[model samples]
Target chain A: MRLLSQARVAGSVLLLLLFSAFTLPLRASASGQVTPQTVAETTQCGHVSLQAMIDEAEAGDTLVVPAGTWQAPIRIDKPLTLEGQAWPVIRGDGSGNVVAITAPNVTLRGFVVAGSGKSLDREDSGIRVSAPNAVIENNRIEDALFGIYLERAADSVVRGNTILGMALPISRRGDGLKIFYSPNTLVEGNVMRDTRDAILWYSPYSVVRHNDFADGRYGLHLMQSDHHLIEENVFRNNSVGVYVMYGTSFELRRNLIAANRGPSGYGVGLKEASDVLMEGNRIVGNRAGVYSDSSPLRPNTTVTYRNNLFAYNEIGLEMLPNTQNNRFQENILLDNGEQVNVYGGGDLTRNEWAFDGRGNYWSDYAGFDANGDAIGDLPYISKSLFDSLIGVQPELRLFQLSPASDALDLAAKAFPLFAPQPRMSDPAPLTQPPALPPTPGLESPPTATNIVVAVAMVGVALTILAAGLRRSKRQRRAISAQPA
Target chain B: MNGKIIWTLAQKELRDALHNRWFLLYTIAFIGLSLALSYMSLAGAGIAGFAGFGRTAASLINLVLLIIPLMALTVGAQSLAHEQEQGTLAYLLAQPVTRVEVFIGKYLGLALSLLASLGLGFGIAGVVLALANGAGSPMAYISLVGQTFLLSLTMLSVGFLVSALTKRAGVAIGIGLFLWLTFVFLGDLGLMGTAITMRLPVEQLLWLSLLNPLQVFKMAAILDINATLDLLGPAGIYAMQEYGAQLRGVFLMLTALWILAPALAAYMRFRLRGDF
Candidate 1:
């Protein structure tokens, strides 16, 4: 009897040791003191219970949220890594921010943060981060007033996220990404569409690269923000592609700005901006490619545009009367309606059109190149009577492309008395257009409707031609048969 | 007023047009030029990929603007003046036909000839372009064709006015050419010069520009290419803002008025002075 009782106590002790081994980590995780190994063992949160898991998680603990719709207005006050396995949705109950990160070093990834409040005054957002060193990436955020609001969050990295704004009108919609007072933020590889703007105000030293912003008001709107490096980004179908106001020292390189037609309709607009270097950008199909109002505002500052291609825009470059210190060189201005327009009527003699014996290739330049050199012998002058008249009176542009305008130009050429003063002169205009990056081709294969339209047009033309000919032949026969 | 009499007279006029060497030459030249323009526009296709239908149609605008007006005016000017010069109108009027019937029938015949020429020329070119490059925005191209037809009718009406006013065919053709030159060149240049000198208000400038049918056609064509009419600059934006939803309808109504006013004037002049 004594031996059997001792064996039963030993079995009970072994079972108790195994139970404590498993329950110790659970208790540690519950107490918010989880080590890395303990977190790994107890990381999986119950489906649809994300806030509870986040509440119990310690600082620096990593939580793997399961795939389900999790209720939101989730607050992470401690530094933690919350990763979703299969894009678990954190849906707000139609009120405040879906996910708010109030602590430093928080990483939120692979989650769909959606359904924020629609109050613009409240600035409701899908993910609102207030602390620094937050990395929010690989998330799809949609139906939110603001996609991501990084307020005073320095050194934050927002990468590979797709942000779609609400279906509100452009004026009512909030910004896709708002970075206010956040310096040294890196926004890369993100796709933003149908938002007001990806605005950065007082946010200096920000690097925005490789992002696609479309169907918005302003692609990247910078106000009083300086020292931004914007590269390899696409801004298309916006009211204005990149508008930098009250800023200085911006470098925009290799960006594509296209089809931005709105009230202002500028691909790149600068007001009171100085020391801007715009290089190798393809600005195409906008109403005005680059519009400057008092740009290079400070004296002794130069705004340089080099090796950029301005093609198919209504006005390649438009500047106010006082815009000066702008140096344009080695760029290609091709097929724009007006290559360079001086808004409100003035000459661009204050700005430099050629530098270092090289100048932009104007599609309307009629000068000839001699001695096998690419540069033209005679200086290229942009002086049109009609363009000047339209400058003074913009309503006269209604007669554009009329024969009278061409005649007026011809008369000015024949009789220099009627010729207006040259708006600009390029002493070393290029004979050949500079090589540009190939435009990304749009896929528009011919559909069945196209084929049907083509065939029908041809059939109609031939039928008309044959009927006219047959009727004419019958009339000729009847007239000949009658007495002559 | 008699349909059978008008149809008979129209058939006779059409037979005369078919036998005329200049008409045939004009049709052939139009087709050749359209084809060449289309081919030249697509020359950059090797670099820019397949040039879409919109770009090609935009390029064709200049050709249509220059050629169509000249063709329509010359044909319309000769339609009545040539018959009156050859004393065939006296013979026709003596044969139980109203003067209205002769005027309406002759105009209809010349209109058909112009339509046939334009349709054949643009159709063949359009087919070639669609076959070569994928047709991007066929509606834009079709709209361009429709605008060109309206322009032709407007110019033809003006030519009929010149024909009714003149007694000699050569004189009528001369006056038509002069009017064409004036409309194409002097009118726009004068308006531009005046606008610069006077700084006319936007509304006044728009009204003055719309007075010229050629300007209307150019604006309509540009609007078709760019739906927002951004290329027309500030004036275009102002027009869009002012007309808003009815901009297209406004253009059409203005064109119709252009056709009707000159045509009614020509009919009145012919009816009053029906003596051969």
Candidate 2:
């Protein structure tokens, strides 16, 4: 009996230590909401009002909301945890913010927040968090003017949420997730579609990773933000994939920016930015893969593009005439309409096309590697006469693939007198393309139907040819046998 | 025009074309070269699998642009000029058939032969591509075939105009080749040079480009394959923006106008001329 009592006391002490380990962070962040409350108070409001539960609860109290459509324009003033048993709906009255969190350490998850006001001036949103350390995760925000607005919410986490903006005209629609003055915010694994822009304004040290932004005005528009890391995100079919204006020390890695084809269809546009590093990106099928306009504005700052694949774009790299201090190295510029075009009538000689004796692989580079060192013996020069003319007069690009343009270039090469000056030259261009990470989601292999169609077409063509020949031969034999 | 006389004349022309050694050789060469071109395009991409129909068709665009018009012009030019040179056209003209009937009949026969050659070549190439790689969407390939057919018709109409004006087969063929060269190179180069020198407005440039039947076919083919005129650059984008949903239809109409204008001119010249 004495030994059994001692063992029970030891187990109780261990349980207490484990419980405190879990609760201590919450107790410290919640600002002295230390009373441990058992039994998460089920909301008495049911479908009527979740705000009543928030009003009745103390700081750090966890409220369990049942699955029902609740009227929003709700506010959480104290630090609280609102957990939905199922995905509950919070429908706004189309006036102001739908679900507002004004208290620090508030956690909102497992809810479908919808129908905010259409007022861009008021900055209406489905979930507006003004307090720091807010966790807004796994909730689906739909048909809201602004999906999620994080205003001054430092160290906030916005994860795994699906934000679909209102179907207004692109200019009229608000941002999907507008992070204003929110420092060190982690926006990861979220999807934003059909929004005007996903704006990161003055949000320094933010990490936006693994998100998908598509069919918007600007996929990720960063303005005056510093030291942001955007990695492994997909920005597709937007007007501009990622436009960085006046940002410093931005790193974009392994992101796929594709098919942005709007008016200013840039996969990644940099305007007066400095110290930007874009590495390992697959920028494909865009109007211009990377557009630089007066980038690296400050002296001694540099913008570097390394190991990116710029494929099938109209212009792989388009820059302003005076844009300088940009370095492009170890990149594969494959089959763009024009590899690099300096917008207006100037050359890209100011920017460095090679660094450390390594240059990019130009698909149109005609030089061969004689010594098998994988470097071209002749320098890769961009001096096509037609390309230069098209740069001056873009409408002449209509004849880009015409025989006339080919003949013009051929004549220029033969005559050498008519050839324009080199726009830019890489001293050591790679004869072979550099290795690139395999693109995700390649097309499936040919199906049986594809084979059948191909065989049938070939058969038909050969049969026609055979029939024609046989008919002609018979006609000749008949005429010859008739005794002329 | 009497349908019976036209049919009889067309049958004669068709039989002659099929019997011609040069025509046979040209058809074989076209088919062989097209297939080889498709193969090279696929292999050149360094891809292990077959490229999609869009890519294969794109690679064939330059070859088609170079060859189809030349073949059509040569065949059409030889049709009337060779017969006239041998005095057989005069013998045929003395028959009950009218000049209009003979003209329409010859055009119809050559059109059928050209269609057969193009169909055989592209169909075989497309089938091989489908079997080898995969046909992502056959619409672009089908569109390319249709555009080439229209281009052949347009060039053949222009060839008939040349033959109507010329007497000797050598002279007609030479003129046809010259016109082919002009259509292939001069128009685009002249316009590009002019645009560069004078800085022509995009609208005017588009209009000038549309005047060239070859450019019309190229733009239409590219637009159909890419589903956007962006590849054509600013003039193409201007066309897209200006024409909106009517861009493809406009190109088709332009190609038709090209065919009708030349065919009409040839008919008028053949009717009014007293050379026979």
Candidate 3:
């Protein structure tokens, strides 16, 4: 009886904690009354352009438009909240915008906006926002040039919008949230497909979270943007999934990027991007996986990856030579043919065995961890072994995994799973897995993993530079003699 | 074979391209169209009621990829085949140059022409796009140049190879088209089939793909870009993605072979083996 009473008391305390956690976010939101009368008092419901519906409104106003097909090219410019009643269809008159807004602290919810004409110039918007603080939620936009555009808007939120179209097969078209020079925007819980790029941002500090993006050139795209978070999104069969563009710093965490290969395409393309954090995402069955290609003029872009689960992708995580200063840590990779090869000729720090000298968990890792934590404490280093042999020997990746794979794992420690030495990871000895079983079968027999692939190209700038140095030539010649 | 010879040949090709304003116009059109598309593509995102729907369809990745193969074929068709069609190769070869030198020189010239086309055409297009898009990927812009270079070299080499092997202009064009289609379209399909039948992981199949230079070049370019590293499914792709240059050594070797073997074969046939 006493134990039961104690248990009830503990349960009550836990329930109290749960209740606070749930209510805290709601409490944080600005307190407002949501009565229809209060909303009517705040807004001016008139038969005007879509912009008027937004401008003539104040905060906490829900503009209930009568059931009528409106015109296209409308603008919203205000800090007001508007909600359409029933299926309030805003139709473009084949010329003007359906809804154009330039307002801060605005929300446009539950509307069907469609039927805009296409033009070579004058990009039409189904629901365009010029305000920084805006939210276009729970809206269905279809059959317009651009479904919804957020231009030069910052710190906006676009949630629960379904956008669909086929404007031009070759040309990029209709967007759910086309954010140009917009920053700190959140596009969450939307379904976007059959367009050019699903959720694209030129501005930084954005989040495309919990969205379903399918059948676009790029599912979620960020170009020349930075500081974005892409989480829990489903990208299906897009040309490429979640393309993080150049000069962008972002985190693609806990998302499904899959099946993004159809009718001439790649899965994900990252060009000239830097300072990336990809964590706990599931990249599966795509044409390729996370490709980063930069130029010679472009400085090296840095990326940090951790705990990502990748499977059935082509060229998983490709980094070029111009792209320097990138790191991968503690990822769960499985069923891949070959893992972790580099191109573009740059420095490679294969510190798989750094943290407690353990490497990432690869299903193809022939090595074993005698201990259980599923981490091979020994460094799993296959430093360009296949590349070195591929010249004279054609069938290199034919037989087993890297024979010269000097893969090893350190003994299980309290927190060292690849205790990175600044090169591979930024902060040494970061967080540890909540709990990991010590892997018993780790550490493949040591072979020559560091077989430097000395490609003596006739025209490559690096090769010419190497030839310019005489003493280095002698060293290279000497090394070439029993190197293989 | 030397830099000076290649440079001179490249200079000549640039001169030829300039003289042929029609050819120059072709590139200019592509550049203008692509740039214009960049602006028009964004319009969908602003269609008022349908802005949300419009943004979802813009896949610049696929659009760029679609442009490449066509670019390769269109540019490659004009290589030696055009000169032969104009009956100018015989005159050039008759002048004080060895067949080997002429072959190397013409290939170099073609490469330079391709570079010019890229720098002026695609590069300008990319810049225009960057300006218009207000936030475009610089990496993709640069990648377009790289892909153009590698693809042009491959196509140029193939053109040279076919031109050297055949006396007929029609044959050269036919062969060039065949090569382009096989590489750009069927190469991946073939490898995919092989992987499925061989029951090997895609990474393990890369060694076999080395035999096919087109697949190798595609893979190499992909690796060079480093953006699609994660998209590569096999363990090999992972290795390439992580240690792209180190692992791409194989593809580089293959690309070198892809460029060199055809050029070398063409040269060998032109220099040593008498035709007629």
Candidate 4:
């Protein structure tokens, strides 16, 4: 009976080996090699057309395209994920979008999408999303008119994608990520370059963070949108860092806007935009740091600026005369050609320069403290005769600090009637520039001078204190007749 | 004004101020703070050596705007107030010196002292900054120093006027501190508060700024710093257009008027005084 049972086991083992050999090839064809058995609804496409496999896939299935270039526009109509096992390149022959997403809950990840149609009017994109809640992540798109175009695709996520556009002129090129009428989208961790605009058009309640936008016309161009959160993005070498128009209640924080030197060349431009909470953003090396044209809607409404660093710009903050009720506090205005430039004459005095005994650090503030208080004993006033000339002519800025200008300033000083009215004033101006957190992508190497100066300052204070104590003791004892 | 009598009284005033340790303190404070500020500005950038001309000039501007005015105001107020309190004015008046001569003489002495202190303080700071940062723009820095002196003159005039108004040295000192606080600190707060509470016109704000000599100095000196033009904003732009080539000249003249008007008022008060 033992011998018979052993023979049966050997036969069963042989049968199992034969069964595995016969079904493995079929399983490989049915499912992707990377995830053969783990994913129950995975369909692998190799040597066969991706469209054919996609057609065969059931709803809610995943189609894995492995390691080959496919030359056709793909359309997804069912709820599924088109995952690239080896970053499959989907090429288009200049007709329609390379990948058309029409179904809800569709995910297109790990793709190398390239060569969309060349017509600007056609709005051809590498991936066009028409359905809501679509996710386009970890895709590398190149040479496309529009990298990712979403129309009415609300609540979608487009993350971890690097989109490279062709070197077309600003007018000829399309946006890297174009979202139209799409609300509540989250765009994160994408590095987009050489596009007309990294983000274009309107998306209400969208969160765009951690994306690096470089060499574009506009890093983020939002129009007629409301309540958007844009933070921690690096916008460098763009024409305009961020062109926000008519956007209300937007929270723009901690963004690095640098080296945007295009025609408009603004780190952040606001036109008729209201209720903007711009905090902790570094507006560095731009032509104009923050340009606002009628940004405030109501007479009493205000856009707030707190703890922002405006450094190495031609003009730090330029606002229109109509832009009123704005507040600036705790911001470091450093090394800008102009700290605040208003056109056509406006009352910036209505705007609060300091709140709660704290104000911005103007690198040009000529104030000092004598009584050991860190606050400057005098207020820092900003006013320039040259500024007024430039405002009216917009041409005399060529001779900004020329000797002629200096002579003119000297003459103004000698003549009391020539003194121009001050534009703004900050009471309690800090003696030291606020110690700011390092900005990402714009951090400078550390230096040791601050420590040395701080130590020296402390030593001086100690000496002064000791001297004062000794003097007081002598005077008191002499007066009381208690000295030996 | 008798130049000989004024000159003689002015010499006496200068010798007294120098001997009293006030001049030393002022000059030392200016030097220490200016150097500290220059170093501080460079320290933040983590850059040693030269931070360029614009940056140092900018820092110096801050120093001048705050310290120069306060120093001038206190010294000017104290000089006259102390003389009146000690009965020296009566003695001097009895001895061939007219009240106008005493007033002009004291003003001249105080102005020279302020100028010397400003020059010495800034000169030392400038040399130190140049040594540390290589060389920036000497002309601009010098121009800034000069403008600060001009600001000092205006504050001195304000001081003299205050001294002439008050009878006691203590009162003069109190008023001096109060004026410094008001013009340099509280004035801005009040203006900004009024602007918020009452949406004052840009023109009105500019006019109101003229009430403070420090503001007058700032408006004039801001043109010297390239970076400050942008901060001048639209109103400044408007002024630039209106003032044109005369902008600086007008500002200087205005600041001078700030000096001359108050000094004249103090002289008139002294000339009319029956207490002497």
DockQ for every model, please: 0.42, 0.37, 0.03, 0.03
Candidate 3: where are CA atoms >4 Å away?
A1-61, A77-80, A172-174, A199-202, A262-268, A294-302, A322-324, A344-347, A350-356, A370-484, B1-276
Question: What's the CA RMSD for each of the models?
Answer: 7.5, 6.2, 23.8, 17.5
TM-score of chain B of 2: 0.94
Q: Which residue pairs come into collision in candidate 1?
A: A404-B184, A404-B185
Work out the TM-score per prediction.
Answer: 0.85, 0.86, 0.46, 0.57
Best by DockQ: 1
lDDT of 2 by residue, A305-355 (tens): 898888767788888877888898989887677888888878878888899
True contacts kept of each: 0.40, 0.37, 0.01, 0.01
Model 3 chain A lDDT-worst window of ten: A449-458
Q: For model 2, what is the alpha-carbon lDDT of residue A339? A: 87
lDDT tens readout by residue for model 3, A64-131 = 55344555456655465565655568777776557777767778888898876665266666777887
How accurate locally is residue B173 in candidate 2, as Cα lDDT from 0 to 100? 91
lDDT winner, 3 or 4: 4
**Per-model i-RMS:** 2.8, 3.4, 18.0, 12.0
Candidate 1 structure lDDT:
0.81
Rank order (by DockQ, best first): 1, 2, 4, 3
Model 1: residue B245 alpha-carbon error in angstroms: 1.7
Chain B TM-scores, listed for every candidate in order, come to 0.94, 0.94, 0.73, 0.90
